[model samples]
Target chain A: MAKVKHHNIPLDQIIKPENIVFKRTKLFTDNVLSYCPGCGHGVAHRLILEVLEEMGIADKTIGIAPVGCSVLAYEFMDIDMQEAAHGRAPALATGIKRTNPDKFVFAYQGDGDLAAIGTAETIHTANRGENITVIFINNGIYGMTGGQMAPTTIYGMKTSTTPYGRDPKQMGHPLKITEIVAQLPGTCYVTRQAVHTPALVRKAKKAIRKAFEYQKQNKGLSFVEIVSNCNSGWKMTPVQAVKWLEENMLPYYPLGDLKDIGLD
Target chain B: MIVGAIVVDTERCKGCELCTQACPFGIISMSEDVNSKGYHYAYLADPYACTGCENCALVCPDTVITVYRMKVEEPSKAKN
Candidate 1:
C-alpha cells in the first residue's frame, strides 16, 4: 500500500472508524478553511465544532460570526451560523439566545471585532447575562483588513496603523476585554487560552468545551478568549509566530481562568 | 510492523511547522517540495516511531493531519 501510485490512500483504510485516532468533525463543512497558513483561527474553529459534535448539539445550536477574519465562519462550520455586522456578534447572539433560550448560542469574534467596534455590545451583553457563549479570537491585529492595530495589540507592537510601534502615550494600553467582562457579574465562566502548542491547543479545546457546558446549564454569559496567532500579519513563520506569542503576548494575556462561577 | 499512519491533505497545507513541533516522536518534517499552492508542506518522516498520539493533528491550525493507529491487543503472560 505504501508503494501505491501517489493517489490518496485507500478510502476504506482512512475511514475505518476503529483505527481512526483523530479526524475532522461532522460540524465542519466540506469547505476548506480560509485562514492563512498557520493562523490560529483554524484550530479554534475546529475545536468548537468538535465540542458541538461531542455534545450532540450541532443541530440545536446557532453561531454568530462578526466581521473580521472570522466573518466567513459560516462557510467552514456546518452548523447553523449567521453573519453579524462588524463587532455586533454579541448583539445578534443576544437576540437569538433570548428568543430561543433552549437552543445553545455562541458568537465567534476577533480582537478588532470584539474589543474595538463591538466593545459596547460585548460589555452590555455579558453584563446583562445573556445566556450565550462568546468565543473571542484575539490576535492583536485586524487580520482581514490587513493587520491594522487592534484594541488588543500590545504596546510597542508594530502594525500597519502603528508603523513606529504602538505608543502607549498616543494609543493607550492594550485593552483587557476578558478581564473587563470577567469583573462583570453577568458572566459565569471566563477564561483565556491559546492554541500555539500541542499542550496549549488541548487546554484551549477543553476551555471551549467547558464554555459550552456552562451555556447549556444556562449559567449566564460564558466568555472564552483564545489568544491565537496570525503568522501572515505578524510577518513570521508559523514556528516563529508561536515563539513570538510566547515571548510577547503570553506575558500580557496569561492563560488560565479569570473567573469560574461553576466552581462556586 | 507499522502501527500508525498519518495522511496529509497536501494541497491544503501551507507548510506551517506547528505539527513539526507538536510531534513528540519528531516524526513530522517540512517538505522541500512545493504543493500546488506554492507552499512547502509537512510530512511524516518517521512513520515507524509514530505512537499515534495525534498531538500533531491537534496543533495543526490548517486541519491537515489525519491519524490512524492499529489497535494493539495486550500481550498475555508468558507460560511458566
Candidate 2:
C-alpha cells in the first residue's frame, strides 16, 4: 500500500500565543517625516526603533545625531539625543559613553560624516574599542547638502559634486567602511545591511540588534552600516531608489557580518 | 481560545495602502476614515480569515501594523 505524505507546519505556528514577543518596539513619535517618498532613511530609522524596543533599552539609550540629512534623527528617536558637529558624532558619542558608562550610547551618521570629514573620529573610536554602537547610513551622496559627492560615492555615479559622474581618475574609488572597521582589533561586531525590501529589512534589524547586544555586553565597539538610498538626491522615485540601491549599491557593499568578535 | 486582535499604530502608518493591497485573504480593507493623525488607515473587516502571515505587517513602510495570532486549543478527546 502506498503511504500518504503530510507536510509539517512550523512549530512557531503551533506554539502558545503568549510566547510571541515583539522583535522591536514602537516608541518612535507619530510625527509625519520630512523625508522624500522613497528614501531608505525612514526605514532605517524604524529598524533602529525596533531594535531599541526589543532590547528594552529606550530609556537608557543616548543617540548622537550627525550633521548631514539625518541630523534631525533626534526628532524621530524618542531616546535622549545630542547634536554633533559635522562629522563629529563619533567623537560626541565617545565622550558620552566614556562619561556615562551605564548608558547605551550610539552615533547615527551618514556617508559624508563617516567616510569623509569624520573619518579620523570614526576610525579612532573603533580602534579604542569604545563601548558604543555606530549606525552608519551610506546613501552615496550628501543628501541634505544638495546631493554633493560623498567619499563613498560610486564610480560613474553622478552627484552635485560629480555632475558628469564620479570618475575614478579624478574622484578616486569608493570607500568600504565595514571592511575598514572590521580590520580594527577593538571592534566587536560589524555588519552591513540594507532596507530595500522586507527580507532585507529583517536582516538589517537583526544586525542592528546584534550591534546593541554587543554594547549591552560591554563588548567594545559595534558598527552597523546600512546601504541606504537617497531618493531625492539620487533623482529617483521611492521605488526607483530601492531598485537602484539593489542594482548599483549592493554589488559594492555586500551585506552580512564582516566581523563578529566576542559574540556568543 | 481567542488570542489577540491585530493592532495598528496609525501614527507611524504612512498610508501607502500596501497593507490593504497585500492582504492575501481579503480580510483587510482601507478605511474611508482617517486616524487621529489624519492619515488613511487600513482596517480588518473579517478577522476570521486572517491567517496571520504578517504579509501586511511586513510590507508596511511605517511599521505600523501588527498581527496577533490567538491561541486556540482543540477539545480534549478524553474530556469530551
Query: What's the DockQ for every one of the candidates?
Result: 0.42, 0.16
Please provide, for model 2 over B1-80, each residue's C-alpha lDDT reduced to its tens digit, 9 standing for 90 to 100.
Answer: 43333567766565655566456555667678887767667776665445455656755666666666644554353247
Once fitted onto the true fold, the runs of candidate 2 whose alpha carbons sit more than 4 angstroms away are: A1-26, B1-50, B68-80
Index of the highest-TM-score prediction: 1
Distance from true position, residue B74, model 1, in Å?
Answer: 8.8
- Check candidate 1 and list the clashing pairs: none
For residues A1-264, write the lDDT of model 2, one tens digit per residue. 112222233334534456443322457775656665456677788888888887889999998888988788888888889999998988998899999999999999999998899999999999999999999999999999899999999999999999999999998999997799999998999999887666777788889988999999999999999998887789976556777888999999988889998676
Native contacts present in candidate 1, fraction? 0.64
What does candidate 1's lDDT look like per residue over A118-149, in tens digits? 99999999999999999999999999989899
CAPRI quality band, candidate 1 = acceptable
Q: Could you say which candidate leads in DockQ?
A: 1
After the best TM-score superposition of candidate 1, give how far the Cα of residue A65 lies from its true spot, in angstroms: 0.7
Candidate 1's displacement at residue A179, Å, is 0.5
Best by lDDT: 1
